[model samples]
Target: MATEGIEAVFLTTHNWGKAAKFFQALGYELDFETDHNSGQLRNGDGPYVFISEIPEDQETQTQIVLKVPDADAFRADSPVEVVTPFEDTHYGTKEMTVRDPDGRLWNLQAPGKN
Candidate 1:
């Protein structure tokens, strides 16, 4: 069988590790871990929570990752100007990032791309 898509829901927090711990306490299993200042936990029914650490001086963050069928074309088709092109993630995904007018970040990912 072919691999299915994956979603990385960006959950903002002062401390991503702590945020992950909180969710883990609630039964979310650690689907993957990373040292790229981000990590993921899975509730098993929906997208995995991807916690990204933010700067102390920066405002809070709100973001989510959509598993696109074709990240490359999506980058080309998105109405919003593509801010970041497809890049390999440390945890394991090829992704592109886009920011809305409100500064909401969206990650378009093609998992297991390596």
Candidate 2:
């Protein structure tokens, strides 16, 4: 299972307001917002980016969204230490991640490309 050029969305900003405006200027529309200071920005079709503010309790974190063909299968087969198990996301995708050797997490997102 493999993703067909999945858009690797990332959270690079600490301010959601500024980030939203910037992406909007760049043509990305604000689709939805998550409770945990996270939100999604969609451009056209695929590769919608997800942005989340740094939690006050948790230090700033950055995530790399990797496209997996079959998120469920990939999660079951992955060798890395799983942080968040693959499950149905609010934006309609199966996502999972593992903290890398350096503690950085790689977010694997597999939207239903069907």
Candidate 3:
């Protein structure tokens, strides 16, 4: 199955406030925020960005989210190496992890089953 392209970008930051302000300065508007120091932002019609705060001791990372119309179909037909099977997320999506030839981890997101 072919991916529907990038759905969003997931970013990890040590300082939520600073990261938010930085994105805001870049013309991204806040979409929603959670009490746990995380939020989504967007610029125009492009893919949204989801930022989460992590402990200062941990290294921050950025991940690109690929959109899939159906996880089960993709899993059954795609040749991508699946690192983790699709699982329902707290934010209400089904997500799976895959590894590229370079060993980079990529996340695939699909709408949760009704």
Candidate 3, residue 60: Cα displacement in angstroms equals: 0.4
All-Cα superposition RMSD per candidate = 4.6, 4.0, 1.1
lDDT per residue (tens digit) for residues 1-114 in model 2 = 455665657775678878888899999998998776668899999788878887556665556687777765664565578897887876588887768789887777776645
Clashes of each: 0, 2, 0
* Best of the candidates, TM-score: 3
lDDT of 3 by residue, 2-109 (tens): 789999999999989999999999999999999999999999999999999999899999999999999778746567898999999987999999999999999999
TM-score per prediction, in order, is 0.63, 0.60, 0.94
Model 1 residue runs over 4 Å out of place are 1-6, 34-38, 75-80, 99-105
Question: How many residue pairs of model 3 clash at the backbone?
Answer: 0
- Tens digits of per-residue lDDT for model 1, 3-44: 145566676677777888889999999877777666778887
Q: Rank the candidates by TM-score, best first.
A: 3, 1, 2
Question: What are the lDDT scores of the predictions, listed in order?
Answer: 0.71, 0.75, 0.93
Worst-scoring 10-residue span by lDDT in model 1:
1-10
